[model samples]
Target: MKSTLKKLLPFAVVGVMSGATTVGALQYFNHDSNNTDQSYFTKASNVSFAGMNSAAVGDDFVKAAKTTVPAVVTIKNYQSRTSSRASEQDMLDFFFGDPFGGKGQQRQRQQQTPDNMPSGMGSGVIISPDGYIISNNHVVAGANKLEVVLSNKKSYIATLIGTDPNTDISLLKIEEKGLPYLNFANSDNIEVGQWVLAVGNPLGLNSTVTAGIVSAKGRGIGILGSQGKAANPIESFIQTDAAINPGNSGGALVNTNGDLIGINSAIQSTTGYYQGYGFAVPANLARKIVEDIKNFGIVQRGFLGVTSLDLSDDQLVAAYNKQKNTNIKAGSGIYVTGFGESSGAEDAGLKLGDVITKIDNIAITDFADLSMAVGSKRPGDKVQVTYSRNGKDATTTVTLRDQKGGTATRTKADLSVTEKIGAEFQSIDDKTKAYYGVNSGAVAKNVMEGSEMAKAGIVDGYIITEINGKPVNSQKDVENLLNKFSGTVQIKYLDDYGRGYQRGFKMP
Candidate 1:
């Protein structure tokens, strides 16, 4: 039976190579062989042996490439600028040889116009079937014109929908429908050594695919500054050995199943090209950014407003031993330096010098993980934060809020104060005056910031019937009366928005 199976193995290989029914042949060979030791099957024909090995690798590459390439797109941007001290006609005539003759036109005028407008090329991935594309903010930043070229060579003009430079993500809209897109994979589940593909238009060459394994996770390159440009820059990058080059900045870094796990953002190289080290913004971070921009005009970032540093191995060991009188476990974690007075961290009872161990059930190995987790949440969202203080582990829930004391909700009446220099004047009417219970006068509901009334200790919600012993009912009348005393305007009005009392200040 083993000899008969060995004889049929060559036929099975040939069947597979020739696009024949190889499954049946392989099944028959395995069943007939029935022998535990299968070394005899290697003695098949050399052509069959070569075919099997090559077919396996070729099939995998073909399948992965076919699935990912269509979702990759080439992005081109054109910036427009206006020249200083020159009419459009003059610039056009200078470049195209002036048809209308003018004096001193042939003097070989020096073109002072600098090339402020630059063209750039990058890559993008289709995230939605209805033409929503995702790319890097730097790729489409300040672009007056954008063009997207698909794998099929079809090009379409793209409009910038929104961008969040803090997360290095931007959304673009195209007119076409039924476009191919890549589904986002759960980046939290991705682990080191997992196979992944990097698809992009590297060096302006469209639709290039490269394969590699994930090298590391939660990498911080400090590309995003402290304020985290635009908002808080989430810097939890998935490091991979994939060859991501310059034009790949906005491309897709997909997993084995052709699902987008990250957005290829940058490569660490001295020559400005791939050198076996590439970085991608995780897909989870990118998704949150895209959603925030689509909903809000700006990314609503929650700020803990605290400075922190990652604990060094030596420091961690020393701290543990000093507290517990034992050796420390080897693990990465962050130490809190201090908390800001007006910060959410302070309000949430987080004190100085606490070692943060985890956030939202995810391990906070370093500042990168903490930043990524915090950046992914919106203002007003609550998160569970775990930390250690004096060798004791503890957890707490903190509600995140914006840095500006939450959203500003103010009305015309709220602005009535000497500190606020804006005024609101109402039209002259009995019902309006009666609404405020004022006698024979309309309420002043508005004030200009630098107006004479503002300088005279008067603000919004001030009621005015007479100015400088002259009757005044409208804003124009006040302006006319104030025009008389440019040097030192004296204002007389009731503080309607504030306490109902007359007050005056000398305008300078």
Candidate 2:
């Protein structure tokens, strides 16, 4: 009886062990990381995973995307691109020899083949409900016609209102109402590493949204003056890495709340594609330009009227110190080299030797910083200027003046054009004339589309010194002379490179 009991006990113990193993296997198989679902080990074990670091929850940009995507748009620019140019023919003659021989030459001069249609595309941000859109100047600069398409697939013909090349911003209107627009955010409040979204028609893909963080602030890429678009340009770009491509120009870069912080302008890449770096014009400055264009028909720029030298420029520092008996070098902020005629600097009692330390409360770290601060000001605005004279800090209030050195606003409207001259002009300013060593000339500001200037291969930044071998001083002089003169008219002009050239255009 004792032997039989022992055998039964061994079998019972084995059965109990088998049952425990099966339960453990089931628990391991159904293991879940959710707090609600836990195994015996997870509940009973004293082990902790708290020492392991976990990422903080990030913002879900869904709401921002929904709010912004509707306001962003695609801008299509259509230009009547005449492929047949005299220079192209000349280049053909030089490289491959004229295909039509000398026969094509006479016809090419007398008649232009205006069939090939050239077009460009970019993005834009609708700022107002009544159809005011902000975009990069290069996007719609020479477009004969502009077409705007919304995210909802609605299309409208956009009118070219005005452009400010200095800031690389252009204002357009679509004559439509009830448009969803994005409000401007305080760009100064945007911090690096803050979440940002770029919404636009990148690569012609409509309503594309990309997310990133603000990589930098107050970045100057120097695309303005060098491009022959503007003389004194201001570029304090908010740099980001939200994958801005070819068609992303003029798109909206918004904060997490979907507020427009900037208008995407340019990309810094050698391959012409997004290699991480993207730039945008600050919303504050852009808004100012839009209001100026809407009210004044042109940007009312405030001129400090001084040829200031950036201390960050090593060559400029060397030249200045050598030319003038003084110890000047980098990190001196901005030093006044000379004064303009009744300029803001002169009015504020700023001297040539003064080193600008700050503007208002913002520090002037460099020229780009100074440009950003002053570039946002209007002609009549008063700003508190801070400087250092002989290493002593000083402050003064300056009444900003226009480029013409006065408070009176300069209007570009109502200037009637006779015939299709295809360009706008102004008598070269004294500063510009002295720089180019030219006595009298009219500087071509806007070279219009399908005009005689465009046909004659004249471009912006060309200084027209003489017409038919006679000096033309102002816009009136140009119109008066062109009105009276007939047949082939020879225009002597100085290119931005200071090289002189002659171009002939026939007018009946």
Candidate 3:
């Protein structure tokens, strides 16, 4: 197991806005649009995987595969580089003339991607007959265009609805009705040892299905935050022995009755292939994310604002106890290490070293449990938190807040994208602007910790002269440019010392 841990690879096969008139680069949810459909999630109480006869196992697998195959799709991501201005192109060619010793060879290599070719391919599960689909955010990130191919070879140009990098879930839409779709089952009710089917277009094999039992639940593999892509990675995965590979991401993980229990996401392997361990995002969490995107344009993630250390490992607990001069037991609960700014936990009197035992009656034995319980809620939702402080049990009500530390509902129109990225920007003062030698720019007045910008190494006092290759003259310009597109955003700026820097992060 130690050797396997060393070789274990956590992979998912896969931030903010500012300003007035932000309208956002990514498309916001339109309440007036006809795509709204909340009926995709089935009642949690209705799903049960109990007392199945062993003799009927083959029949159950057949039934599940038959029901879900048609709803799964092959997603082809198409992206073409935006053409640079000819003058800028010429200047580059003139200055750095083909390092390969052939005229324009370097330039050609830079722009070698054919416009008609797909940049990446993965799978998606249709959740609504009106053409709402759910897939992994990594599957469709940075695509200039998305094409969805159904089982029957029917294709449609898909539109990205919204994405939650924290959960690795993305919502997509296509123009068609009366299509086969999957209903979200109560993932909370799924049990280990119960049979589940992994259905997707793995390795470009369309409409493929593999069978396995649920090996574990509430498992955190730390896959989403592997590269700091997700500042607040919410990873409570349903682990299975199913054979999920590169293309299985964003695909369906369903139960014997063909109810969608999870979305097949990451795999634990040494060679980047399935190695008997696979993980999926719980259907309940994915359902909440898509719904939030449908209703609010961005994920309405609620933050408890407390950072803590998981007490699941005995060795770590012993070391921590020795260091802190306390008898902290392993598997007792997560111990609070610190609190974020405007933290509800701190305000509710949760002190450092408090062991969080439960949230609203749900056991908080590990980070996964804590994440799911809190990750499922939105800002302003109150949770009863039970904790042990100095071996004394106490309860408190914690009202969650959005990343911006507000309890108000967040909509694209009301929140600046800049604020979403964990930074607040203002037009640079003329002196600072002249010092940086930029005609137009915004000063990063504040950069929130653990935000996408902060993760990208952006700091306060950075002069943002360009974003997504467009000039940003004012806070409003920053807002407008950010709202103009979705996916990865490139930023060029200058440090407080006037040294130039460039950074990029995925748009939240």
Candidate 4:
């Protein structure tokens, strides 16, 4: 009976093992057949695999960074100031109080006055192998002492060759020759999502590089100079998601090929630190400024003499509806709100409310395109501008003029207001006349406090037709005539209603 029971147990165990094997085989076959329906994924496990395939596809960025970084530089600046006596109220409080330090000690402290010491730090890009560097004007502006440090750890005292605060571009020169430098690329060709690298000295950290992509282009952040001030203030900027901090200003924004694409200038952040959005001066504009600095010692921006606003999608639609009878459509061009007298636009016969559609055959789809086209030229260069008026497309050849509405060369060291009459002015074109319902001459836009005009009771928007009894045809004419006068001068003009008036003042 024991032998029979043992044989039965062995058979029972074998039967159980066979049944488990059969079930496992059936499940494996069923899973494999289900996965076969999706060729891309042989198994459900394949769906969870994570990796990037594009990283293996590009060599452009690595090669570009190698070329661009050497041309980038670190900039340091120093300024000096003197402190003066405080107001009478403050002096009385110091002499009367000071229960914490005693009267004698307070008296001694008052005798030893304290003033602020100037200090600044920024970044720059070497544009020429002969030691020409470009940076933001604010970096070196009002700096009594300028110093430049190279990638090789070599430092040199830099000379302020020129600066244009309107465009916020400054040029510097070092005595050295044959330095490593970068060449500017066509910023108009930069595309969204393209890889870019920002190299600079951030937070005073020497030679730092951060990666990002072009988030946008042709951004106007409402930070431009006024008329008779720097003519080309508030330039269109290249916006990026690069991690730019305070000290990154004036750094290089280079493409993967190591070519200069833009100059990192400002960032949009609430905490005064990196918030993912950084602004850059397009290389196209920077190149123009650099060239002007090298040639004329100043940035001679071509003046259009028009106030413009970017058209939103809805506004474009409305414009298209208004121009339905013509080939022009809304959202397809820039609208001119006002025109300045003797401006390039005025000379070109461009009217207020005209929509600029193209320049030199290049389609102007937005303000960025227009800015890029205009920024590419000097003050005297002529270009064809196309616009739509009353549904008809027309072309006009406009000779670009300086901010003064005349053909004049500029230098980097030239301050628009300080170099001239220390005041701002705008032309009184037909459009301006129509807007104000009357105009006879150019109007004063702004008078700097303590300037020659300010001391003379000259108010902003005051019309001026003559200076020192000489006909002032344009702002340039005013500037030229004022330069001829040293102490006192006479200004003549008509008010908004064409009423003649005259005034006399002393010049600094």
- The global C-alpha lDDT for each of the candidates, from Candidate 1 onward, is 0.66, 0.75, 0.77, 0.68
Error of 4 at 349 (Å): 3.7
Off-target runs (Cα >4 Å) in candidate 3 are 1-56, 81-112, 314-329, 420-463, 466-508
Query: Per TM-score, what order, best first?
Result: 3, 2, 4, 1
lDDT of 1: 0.66
Top-lDDT candidate index: 3
> Model 4: residues >4 Å from true position, as ranges?
1-62, 84-118, 225-231, 307-309, 313-332, 408-508
Best by TM-score: 3
Task: Name the Cα RMSD for model 2.
Answer: 16.5
Q: How close is candidate 1 to the true structure, as a TM-score?
A: 0.61
Q: Is candidate 2 or 3 superior in TM-score?
A: 3
Write one digit per residue (lDDT tens) for candidate 3, span 357-396.
9999989988888889998999999999999987799999
- For candidate 2, the per-residue lDDT at 25 reads 36
- Supply candidate 2's per-residue lDDT for 162: 79
Residue 484 miss distance in model 1 (angstroms): 29
Higher-lDDT candidate of 2 and 4: 2
- TM-score to true structure, per model: 0.61, 0.71, 0.73, 0.63
Model 2 Cα lDDT, one tens digit per residue, 1-508: 9986765675467446644743463355334312110110111122222121111212457778989999998887775433446545544543344578686567564554242333667889999999999998877865667888889999888998877778888999999889999999999999998878898875545787877678889887666666666667898999887766667888999988999999988876644445567888999999999988898777788877778889977887888888887787677588888998888888779998788888887888778888888889888888888999987998999888876677766664432443346577877678888898778888887774334676566787788888887887888888878775558887877767666656677762
Tens digits of per-residue lDDT for model 4, 1-508: 9986775675467546634743563454433332110111111111121121122213665676677778888887765432333222233332343344455344544644232322667889999888999998767754657788898889898988766666677899999888989989999899988888888876655676766788888886545452233445656889887667666788899988888999888776543445457789999888887877788765566767787655645665566557654333446678887777677887779997788888899987777677767866777888899998888999999888876777666652345433555576666677765654333457776564334564344567666766765655467777677654577787665544444444456654
TM-score of predicted structure 3: 0.73
